[model samples]
Target: MYQPEEIRILIVDDEPSILKFLSLGLRNEGYQVMTAEDGLSGVNAAQEFEPHIVILDVMMPGMDGYEVCKLLKDIGNVAIIMLTAKDEVEDRVKGLNLGADDYMSKPFSFQELLARIQARIRNQFPHMMGDVQVGPFRIDDRRKEIRYEQRVLSLSATEYELLKYMVVNHGLVLSKATILDKVWGYDFGGQENIVEVYVRSIREKLEDREHQLIRTIRGAGYRVDLP
Candidate 1:
């Protein structure tokens, strides 16, 4: 029942029920739907699908949603929505800290998914506005410019999103999942290698070099905190 909409979507969940249900429902709504059962595959599917949005399961076997999210975000320009059973604020905060675009709790309804998808579509068309300042980086939405130390940084669409997401979540020890969700959105299902690429790109673009900013959290993901 997939509609004729131009938007493509990816749904990642460990549960077959959730994945199939969402895929069916979303397709019926005029979107091209793809799915993945595990975090790693989800990343691969995302890249191939080139989805407009990614719906991620927070808890999954093999690498987990958080890690997948992080890797995905690192690549750039995808919208991520994290769905989870854990309703704790910490979990929510963790997802947000990682840079997910939105979140949903488990047992969510089809109607809710439709609504969320609609919103994601709406986001594709923007209302150009003022700049967003985070740390030393300045995002000029109007000019589509990024400045660090008065030096303009050139970026691809994905790179812009990656940097913006990181700066927005500064001071948070964001996991890859969180960053992926925030920057890439849930719709991107592809290899996690993209995240690494973008982070490296961002580091070269933003990091002062002398003072290390984007630091790896060992067991966690990445962080950009001021000293």
Candidate 2:
């Protein structure tokens, strides 16, 4: 499992007290936390810091949460939890439509927010959480290891990441570009064929010579399905 210290959180709010309160609380929980006073700064920090989750306030002075949420979704893979003093259902729907993963009205309990963060981490990035099972493969995130039918599979660092990414997103026919962008970061200098090479290596280690575990889609990328 990923330790809390490995998870980065970005909190953006106009209120100084709210920022301080959340920063201290999340820090105490062992999360790597960063704060921004407004929507613009939050977007800037997300680009530089590349936080896993963004805690955004809806009613900011300029470039409200809605706009910020749109821009953030365009930027990279990030889970957003919106905060608002408004408790209307319309407001919640609006946030969700714009790509916020979760929402919380003001005056929410700190414990509840903490729970939501954990939930998002599990739901959106299952590979980062604790043990996960897909088909006959079991992933131990804390140990950074994978076992197939109780037999440990030797995997290099990149192979481990690629396999975990595919396994966590089981049953999805991931495109080559998408896999490259997600596993190898957008900044990776290698060619897209690198994905094919890693897939071959992982398949060999999994003893999937028949290509049942990680199957390549014709004209698409690949998929891992539960049996």
Candidate 3:
């Protein structure tokens, strides 16, 4: 079992209250917490503190969370959970598309936030952690790398998670709701179209006319047909 004390979290929000609240709450949960006021400072903290996970606010002054998320993704393998005040699906999708591991809207309970953090950690570092080999695809969770037929595939964090989930459950049809729940966490209240977006993105990278690794089951969902 992974201990909370072993995980370090960075909270990046413009709102001082949110930073304080989340910092205190996460610390109380035995996690090492760091807080930053703006996206630039958050980036600095991420580089300096080297947290395992980052809780980022979508709306921020100067450098926005999207840019921050992009920078962080490029910088390290830190898991990001975007926070938004708006309940818009576009916002959630945008964050996820930007490599955010998960998202949470404002006025969210601390318990829910904690759960999201833990879930992200678990997904990133599972207990029975090992690489998944389905056909020509190799999903490496620890290194966050994917290889197809000896060629490396460039995938975002969210894309890697979705692909790993499908590869782990190869030959099984997975509904959009189930994909959302597993990959994005149960706190996701956005439309199922996000799954379609990620699926298309993954297919573009991993599939071709001759090798169709993923199949879209009409009226059912999607499945990764292993060779």
Candidate 4:
């Protein structure tokens, strides 16, 4: 996975002070963060934020951390570290039982919490945002490098991003809009043809003229599968 610098985190607690402290400390440690001061609000923020990690407090008004954690698990498998004064064995057990990846007792040092969250994220999505291999294609997510069959194909930065995006989502019929959204970010003006242009370039550079992995879906955008 990418380092803490690129990781997005959510810190949820009723205590504004703790939320502020963790947010500052996590940001200083090179992680992005969003905070919520209550349990129900935390859930809603999580839905919108799509954070990589969530720091939750056990006691909160309305929903509480356990319920929030359970609800998050149902939505998706996000790394969760519970932060609370309830340090009893049963409390820890309950937190883990509720699908928390880890827990931190209150009065926690930021160093420990940050370390635990990083480790948990690594375990969850080790290859997606990290060095990865899919068939003959080798990907270095950090440096944004890719190679096929030991040959490095010359690619422009956008072309590289587009190709890497396709390989990462191999076998998915990704629409041009979806590709633009993920690779070009939110500011991409309407330019659907840009995707078609780059996809064709990637095909020319990465594959032999005889065999190609990128397939046009007629009405859809593209799909990446082994040739």
Cα displacement (Å) at residue 168, model 4: 23
**Candidate 2's residue-wise lDDT over 105-143, tens digit each?**
998999989978876785567667778666687888778
Please, what is the whole-model Cα lDDT of each candidate in the order they appear?
A: 0.75, 0.88, 0.84, 0.81
| Pairs that collide, model 2 | 1-141, 1-142
Candidate 1 to truth, TM:
0.55
Q: Per-candidate RMSD vs. true structure?
A: 11.4, 7.9, 10.5, 12.2
Least accurate 10 contiguous residues by lDDT in model 3 = 125-134
lDDT of 3 by residue, 2-115 (tens): 678888899999999998888988888888999999999999999999999999999998999999999999997888999999999988888877789888888898887776
| Winner by TM-score | 3
Off by over 4 Å in 1: 1-4, 125-227
- Output the lDDT of residue 47, model 1: 80
Compose the digit string of candidate 1's lDDT tens values, residues 172-205: 6777765676578879787666787788877876
lDDT of 2 at 154: 92
Better of 2 and 4 by TM-score: 2
1-227: candidate 4 lDDT, tens digit per residue:
46666788999999989988889988898888999999899999999998889999999988999999999999986889898897799999898778887778879787777667755664455554577666788777567678888888788899878887777567768889878876887697878998988887888997545435888888987988864
Residue 131 lDDT in candidate 1: 63
Best model number under lDDT = 2
Cα error, residue 201 of model 2, in Å, equals 33
